[model samples]
Target: MLSRKEIVSILLLLTAMICILNAALFCNIMPIATSYEQLAQQTINAGTAYICILYALSTWVYHSNYSEPRRQIRYVLIAMLILLIAANLAGLVTVVKTLFMSDLSEAMDMRDLFSSFGYLCRTVAAVLFVITLLLLIIILIIVTITACNHSWSISSRQDSKEDLP
Candidate 1:
């Protein structure tokens, strides 16, 4: 079996790659933002990017501590991976839709190619992204506090040992 650190490393790498791909997809969709609706989509994309960073940071903090419940941690990480994948897939679909519509509009000499449905899809993805980020933030806070307590207790024990005759 892989060690805890190794597992964390792998998960972090996967998270990083997913975030990068998601950002790339958002960037690809950015050039067509010429209206308020498109601006809202861009805003959502920015928020999702920030949340992705928070998720990554939280994952690192939670996984670095060995005292946390391994099974629960594994489940949480797996859930996060699934959610991120779902969101990325949603974003990918939106990008494809936007590109296709843009092409069709261009060929037809139309002015706008964006669809409300695509915006809704992007909105759903952003919601998922925010949910995962919130979950990770909670995990990070709990793990950090637990780690501090553990270290404090260990230090007290060592000090007591040093005082023994």
Candidate 2:
């Protein structure tokens, strides 16, 4: 049961964190002057992006109610819940790859594979994946603010009306 102010403030802070983390992700993953190992490190170290979303969702649930929006909130919550699960699934993939398909992970020698088309394709795929992850962060921030503010503003008006009577 967060006070309305607390909810707004928390959401704002989460939005800021999302923006910063996304910038870091983009900076590290994009085809810059950085080494290939730096890009790999960025991918492997991208845990904070998902964790922030999970915590923000948890905060929303604690503060939100069914009266917030009978239909839209349900749909939105379901979608975010799915995303949280998917993020965990992705993390599991990271762990599995670490244990099984990690031959080149140590050597990172793409000299042989770099000449192959598949390696280039895979690198592009990973870069796009990180871009999508950043997009999700922005989406969550927007959805949270729009939904919460709509309900909060309406409630404020009703409070004023009740006070007048």
Candidate 3:
């Protein structure tokens, strides 16, 4: 039977797949830009969807222990979690800004509001994507350093035991 972590990882992977599919659909439906504003809006939506998919994949990797260096996994996990939280907060900020703004109704019609909101969301998601990428790189470095130390310690212990005998 799979462990709880494995189960969660699988679920996350599934979610990531769904997000990817949705992103593909969004890209497919994107209209040819007649103006700079239209191009920007489409680009933002596409970028946001892609970032969200990447974030989901990162979550899966963290949960699955796919390449986790055993000794440093906990620290890596914690750091990744912190970054994920920040990313989520950025997304939340985008939503709140779009939904609760006093001038939301006056800004544009329904279609315009949606496009504007998507653009803002994309901006936040891009920031989140960068943070998540940084977290992954940092964790990989920590894992490598700790793995080397662990191996060195084991070898030293074996040498000491041989000398005692």
Candidate 4:
């Protein structure tokens, strides 16, 4: 069985990886903004990136805290992630809505690819954001329960030892 510290460390590392991926997606993978449509797309990309990074960092710091009954801490972390995901997604949706109805009169012709790409990118980002948030919650619950059970078992053993000759 993994020690409490080991379990906690693994969770933290996972959280860090999540954050790093988000930051990379935003800073590296996202395209540069030009027109309103591209700008909207880039904004969603950046927002989702920031959201994931914050969620991971927050979960790492929040759960498995110094105190026991880590459930409270886990719940808080989950709530934060939920709010972040919701807010970022809302922004992405707004950007997409605007992009879809953007003033494309300047175009000498109409093409589906240019304006709608942002929608697809943001949509993918939104889905990934949800997945990461859910995974964080699952990880937190698993680790917290394991640590709490370990703590209880150790305490029980100490009680038995103290009562002996």
Local error of candidate 4 at residue 67 (angstroms): 16
Off by over 4 Å in 3: 21-68, 102-112, 115-165
lDDT of 1 by residue, 113-149 (tens): 4356545545544554444344434544544454566
Q: In order, what lDDT does every prediction score?
A: 0.49, 0.49, 0.46, 0.51
lDDT over C-alpha atoms for residue 131 of model 2? 48
The predicted structure with the larger TM-score, 3 or 4, is 4
List where candidate 1 sits over 4 angstroms from the true fold.
1-4, 7-60, 63-68, 102-165
Residue-level error in angstroms, candidate 1, position 123: 20
The predicted structure with the larger lDDT, 3 or 4, is 4
lDDT of 3 by residue, 1-165 (tens): 974434434443443443344334422233445334334433443443454455445545544434335445545444554554454344435434444553656766534644655555444444443443454344435445555676678688889999995
CA-only RMSD, every prediction: 10.6, 11.8, 9.2, 7.6
The sequence of per-residue lDDT tens digits that candidate 2 reaches over residues 24-122 is: 643243354544544443443354344445555555465545655433653465366357436634633543353336688567753453444535444
The clash count for each model shown is: 0, 0, 0, 0
TM-score result, candidate 1:
0.41
Considering summed lDDT, which 10 consecutive residues are worst modelled in model 1?
Answer: 21-30
Candidate 2 vs candidate 4, lDDT winner: 4
> What TM-scores do the predictions have?
0.41, 0.42, 0.39, 0.42
lDDT of 4 by residue, 1-165 (tens): 975544545554565555345434532333444345434434544554454455445545655535554545545544654554555455446544443444663563333534456445445555554554555465556655665676688689989999999
| Model 1 clashing residue pairs (backbone) | none
Superposition error at 132 for model 4 (Å) = 0.7
